[model samples]
Target chain A: MFSRRLAFFLVSLIALLLAVVAPAAAQESVTLDFYFPEATANNAQGIFEEYAAQFSEAHPNITINVVYQGSYTDNRTIIQTQTAAGEGPDVAVMLSTDLLSFIEAGTVVPVQQFVDSTEGGADYVADFFDAFLLNSVDENGQLWSIPFQRSTPILYYNADLFSEAGIEAAPANRDELVAAATALTAEGRSGLWFPSEGFPIWLFTAFQIAGGEPLVAERFDQVFFNTTATAEGLQYLLDLSKVHQVMPEGALSWGDGPTIFASGQAAMLVHTTGSLTRILSEAPFEVGTAFLPFGPAGEDGTGYGAPTGGGNLYIFANSSPEEQAAAWEWVQFLSSPEIQADWTARTGYIAARESAWATDTLTALVAEKPQYAVARDQLAFAGKEFTAFRSIDIQNVINTTLSSVIAGDVTDIPAALEAAQAQIDSLLAE
Target chain B: MQAALPVTNRSVSPARKPWSQRLLPYLMIAPTFLIVFLFTLKPAVSAVIDSTLKPARLAQDPPAFVGLQNYADLFNPTHHLGARFGGILLNTVLFAFGTVAIGMPLALGFALLINRRLPLRGVWRFGFVYPSLLPLIGAASIWAFIYADQVGLLAAILRAANPNWLGSPGLVLGAVIVVNVWSQTGYYMLLFLAGLQGIPRDLYEAAALDGANYWQQLLRLTLPLLRRTTLFVLTVSFTFAFQAVELLQGLTEGGPGDRSNLILYFIYQNIGERRNWGHINAITIILAVIVLVFTLSSFLFFERGGRESER
Candidate 1:
């Protein structure tokens, strides 16, 4: 009996040792916490989860835990708080505009670091669209993030309305646009709708760029809102509503613009490419897509530019080395040409990488759905979104000025622009 | 004998206790005090400290002591915030007073109606209080749809005029105030109902015996007796009005160009958008001081009135 008891104790001890040692002897497994905002569409989350599952299956030793953060704004807050508390996710899809904030907080490592250490680094970096890469890089030419879901502001018109108004085609220049809009404004319908709320600066930037005035300096420390081009551009926007009566009387809401256009209240709508799928599915009339109208600078000129807008994948510096490596793998997987093509097919966001457009799926999709090609074509005229140190405050000042200008509350465009520039300068100085 | 004698003496001199015995009550309260200090007092004190420092842009740069510069900047007309502070403050005051002035009487009327013997009293009470149960953002969204131009329910009903409820700068605050009143009246009504229940039945009977009409009784007896409840309701509603953010965020977003911007929303924007912690904390301190002064003055006034009544 004593001998049997001794054997039993020895066997139990061996089993415990094996339990602790076997996993350590095997390859190291990493689990990464991936955070992304909940997409507006229902299937987006499901698609992302499936992608994550596929990634995990291919890389058996790595696990990707996907968490649905709230909207883009909410994700900003959550990431800030969580990272400050040293509990940020390994990977997150953060706003491209928030790159500076994350960098200033010392919470994110540049994507260049990870890419350089990996295979096919140069080719991978070169694959992204130049417009997107412009926003992703800093002053020193360091790539801070990888573009994921990107978009550009494009013109969505009612072709049937244009035909009724005796317009031959979508406007290619400012003069043509105004003429078309004037003709379209009859009976109960408005000529055009430009969203004046929720990132008004994005659409406004297109106008400013078209007028041959970049709103801010490359370093973001200086703004030229009081310039002739800026004032002229802003005045033109105001004339569309207050003077020409081609648009809504007061501040038109960004959220309501799509709905209004879908209901045929507006002949033309200016919005992001992200809304293409929704508009196509919802619009009662045949939806037409066009590049935003060029100003004096013309199509090939520096004046005609639309800001590239959307979120990008960022790896947190707080993550462990293993976790960071695993996250980079997942990021590369998600950003591959095939996956990007699939993503573009599922959602209307522009494919971030040029190679993604070359994929058979995307080529076929653009053939079937020609509207998808407009945003891609517009990329040639795309510029960086307004981003700088304290960008939100600067953007708010410009947005407020734009709002007042559009509302006819601030009639003097020069004065409004001067005030906004002063404010932005002060913000940047601080 | 010795033990019995000591016990009797201990009972006679219970005040002369051991250290543990003396500290028992304090020890029992230590946990709660610690929690309060950590959650409430710590943040409040830190915010006060933060208000005195310059906002740090980079992690490498430690926050520098800026003295009263942030506060001064708030009033400096050359600065963007400095120019807007006056209007924002005025809006906040108007919002508070408007909500109270409109909300209190409506709530009192609701309380009086429900307190009396009536038909479907339960259903009516539930209906009246239902808005309070809905989340602020949810209610604001619903109101947004209702207030939407052209296609909204308001436009549908009032076919003659298409009023931009939230878009019009002049009408936006009043529209928001109406929504606030709708949400809070039910809560204040419940409070007034409790206050009314506490009032003696004989007071109304005595007023009736004196040939007082409903208005006279309400103005004289009910109003005087419900002063404490009204004070409480006013203070709470004032704080709620001052801290209004969800409605502004959901419906108007402080637009048609900062016409409806409130102090709390301003502070929130500073934090979330601008990351100007020092400036935000300064504004927070200003708001706190204003709320404190208002509350304390009201208390003092009430206390003086009570003393006069005693006299």
Candidate 2:
């Protein structure tokens, strides 16, 4: 009996020893906090979980804790506050607009050096879609952040309304658009609705680019929004309400143009291409996508697709070198063509990397649904987040001005535009 | 302050003074004072100091020393101060006075109605006070759903009448104020009811002997005796109504275009939405001063009236 007990004890001791040493023998695992800017309890978390699972399976060397920090504003504030307190996360996915500020604050470390240190880093050449790649680079010519989820502006319209109105498909020019909108506005529906408060920047950019006029002064240091071109653009939207009387009474206050369009209250809306997937999945009626309409005089103009607006993975300067290396590896894994395709399939974001389209998964997706090709085709015109305007206040000033016009509180387009410019210029000087 | 420490009366015997006896009072009270000092007084003192300085950060990127420039900027009338923030201040005052003005009378009336023999009086009192027990967020959420433009309870009511309540700016503030009144009236009614029950029955009997009518007896006996209660209700209701951000934020977020930007909501937007800490801090100080002056003046006026009446 004594011999039997001794054998059992010996067996148990060996099992315990193996259990304790197995983890210790492996390479040490690093814990990383990944701040997700657009994440909610909704679809964003599941997408991140898939990536995290794949990454952890491949590399037991690292662990990333995904934390949703509310909206862009909330995430930015939390990051700013934490960085000030010297406790920022190892990796943060923040808005492209915050790129300049992050660089200026010295909160993020440039990953260019890491690439150079690697064996085939030079071969990688740090490629990105022309606009996004350039935008990710700081003034000192150092790459600080990388594009992840990118979206371009597209005109979303109700096909049911268009066909019923006998509108010849979707309008491709300014005059065509005005006529189409007028024709579509009958009975219970308005012709077109724009989210003036939520995304005025995109609508304004699209029109300004098509009109062949500068939206702001060079260096973004001065504002010229009151110029004839912009005034005409502002007047174009306002005319729908004041002159055409084809728009809703409260479009100025609307933040969700999707709901408005889906409800069939508005026949047309200009929103991000990212919205395409949601509409296709959720809409009760047929939906259509088209390149934005252009100005009357300005033809042969390349459609302006602004650099996709979403967060990018960034390594904070406060992280240890080892942790930074691990974070970079995680970013690279996420940026891989297969992962990129997976991300696009799951989330409706266009692939940030050019090579992602060549993957078999993306090819299969494109073959299955031809509309995905429109987003890919528009990549050629994607413009970077205008580096000259390094401040978010510029957009705020412009949006407020546009909202005022929409509200009918400011009727004189030129005067209102001038007021917006003055406000922005003053903010810049401060 | 230093000399005030050793003021215990000599009538106390030393033999009765155990260490615990000497220390218990201080020990029990220390925690409350410490918490109050740490959370309230310290922050207040810091805010005052911070307010006097220009809205500046310190260190390698210290805020620019504009000394009093922020305050100067706030009071500048030629600028868009009124359009920017004055509306909020005015709206706050309107909301405060309007809620109390409507609420106190309704609460008192309900209390009086139920004070008499009525069916299921206990159940009625419990039902009236139930809403006050709910947290502001919980209450506001329900009300927000009720006032929802699309499928809300109030919207359904309006749809039965007419389907245009949510889209109109004219009715939007009214909708919010109504919710505020509903959530708060019950709590104040309970207070008034307690005060009414505490009044000596003899006063009413004596008035009855004098052939006073119900209104006359109420005026002579009930109201005069309920002065302190009235004051408490007014001040407390005004504070709660003035700080009604949950309902405002949950229901409207001060939108349909800043039409409902009450002072607290406006402050929250400036800080949370705009991220202009300087403006937020400046607004905070201004609001504190406004609240201080208004309450103090009310106290002084009421106190003076009381003294004059005695004379």
Candidate 3:
């Protein structure tokens, strides 16, 4: 009986050892952690998880772990804290505007290095839209991030309200914009709403670009806020509310603007194209989409621009080479034409790659819901968003000044712009 | 037998003792010491060191030692810091004191009422404490909806006025203060209730026998006895009020020309947006000094009160 028990124990122990060694002998695998912010509108997390699962199925030797971090700001905070402690996710989706900061912290590796080493690298790099590439590449021509989910500000108007007010079509220029807004303002509803609370500067950048003045220089050092064109743009925005009385009296929050527009409190709303899907489903009235109206200085129809807004995928420097390679594969898979087209159809975000728009899936989607095509067309005139040496500081200064000016508190537009310019200059000097 | 025991109690100087024997006490404390050192002391020291350096873009340029330059820039009127510092400080002070001034009395009244015999006393206590249990962010969101311009509860209730509670610069801070008071009063009431319960009932009975009215007894006995509790509650409330970030982030975001801006929000903006760690650490150090002074002064006042009571 003792001899039989000893043989049974040996057999069981050998079986346990084989169970552990079989997987290791079969194939080597790497598991990567991909962090992204929770989308405020669409069911982004579920779609992202599906993408990860699909990617894992395609590459059976590699695994992708999706972590839905909080908001963009919260994600940045987590990345900063984790990287400072010498550990962070293998890859993350961060704001394109924060690319400079990420590069500065030495936390992210340049995408060019990975792209150059990967198969079909040149074609992959060329697939992305040139407008979105502006924020991805630095002055030295180093590619730091790949555009994932991108958006541009667009005009959303109530077509029913416009017709009721006898407006023929959406506004094409500043003059028509003001006229349409004036006609739309009636017993209870305001005609226009531009949020001043969050990312006000993004909308203001659109205005500046439309007015024929880019806010910052190419070197990301100097700002042109003190220019006459910029002041005109600021005055135009302020006049919508203070002079034309076509908007709410005081400051309107970004979080509230969508609800107000959907509820028909405002006839027109200037917001990110990411809201297209949400607004379409929620608005009680017939929703019409159009490109932002060109400023007075812009050419009749061609010289208009809006800043690109959205997040990009970045690989961390602290990750192992194997992990980084796996992360690159995951990114490429996620940004492929088929996936990008599907993502665009689900979320209102524009496909980051030009080829994604040409995909049969996306073409069919655009035919079904043509509103998605307007934002893609506007990408032709899209410019670089406000990014500088200290982009956030510069943005805050401009946003604060714009908020005060729009609220009718700062009557002197040029003075306010000058103060903002000085602030940005000092930050750049630092 | 004693000799055969081999002198196990041999006298050895502590300096010559075994390493484990010498280190046992330190070993027992090492875990806590390491935690405090890593978390608290290390960051405090690093903040000081970071404050004295010239601000540099992290990866491109290394920071140089520039003593007091950050502090100087913060005070220079030509800079952004100098332009907004005074107003932010004033707003913080107003927010902290405004909540305390209005909230303490309301809490005291509720505590006094709940102390008396009433129907469903347990239910009344829970109802009084419910607001305190709600998360600040949730409360802020609710208040934001209430303060909305067109469809808000306030707009519906005050049909003629249509006050823009959070949008108007003049009224935004007051609106925030009202939310803070509403959320915090229950907590303070609980503290006051505990203090009220600790007071002996015989004292109130003796005062009644002496023909003292309820008002006189409360003024002379309850108020004097609750001094310690008041001090604690005030300090806690002041600290929390000064660090009001979640509510501001959720509701107003320090907008309408920075009318409702506080120092904590300013620090957060600097860290999250600006990435100017040197400036952030400088501001943090200054805030720490202010908090230290406030806490010390309160403790000193409490000590003096204790001494007087002893006399």
Q: lDDT per model, in order?
A: 0.82, 0.68, 0.83
lDDT of 1 at B147: 85
The regions of model 1 sitting more than 4 angstroms off are A1-27, A38-43, A297-304, B1-15, B273-275
lDDT of 3 by residue, B134-230 (tens): 9999999899899887667887788447766777778889999999998999999999999999999999999999999989999988988888888
In model 1, state the lDDT of residue B300. 81
Clashing pairs in 2: B56-B63, B57-B63
By descending lDDT, how would the candidates be arranged?
3, 1, 2
**Candidate 3 ranges beyond 4 A from true positions:** A1-27, A297-303, B1-31, B60-62, B273-275
Q: Report the lDDT tens digits of candidate 3 across residue range A120-166.
A: 89999898888998999776878999999899989999999988888
Which candidate number has the best TM-score? 1
Which ten residues in a row are the worst by lDDT in model 3 chain A? A294-303
Query: Which docking class does model 2 fall in?
Result: incorrect
Q: Which digits, one per residue and each the tens of the lDDT, describe model 1 over residues A196-276?
A: 754567887886676657776787567766787667777787789777888866677777777888988788999888888
Tens digits of lDDT, candidate 2, A1-430: 9999999999999999999998776537888889887622137777887788889999887898988886676687688778867898998788766766666566788878777787776545444566566556665667777677766666778888888888766676777777888888865566887665433565677666666665654444555566666777777777777688767543242334566577776788777666666667766888887777745534453334333466677889888887899888888887777887877776667787778888898889888866666666666655544334335545544655565565555567776666666665555565
Winning model by lDDT: 3
User: Comparing chain B with the reference, what is the TM-score for each candidate?
Assistant: 0.91, 0.82, 0.91
Q: How far is candidate 3 from the true structure (C-alpha RMSD, Å)?
A: 4.5
Per-prediction DockQ? 0.48, 0.19, 0.45
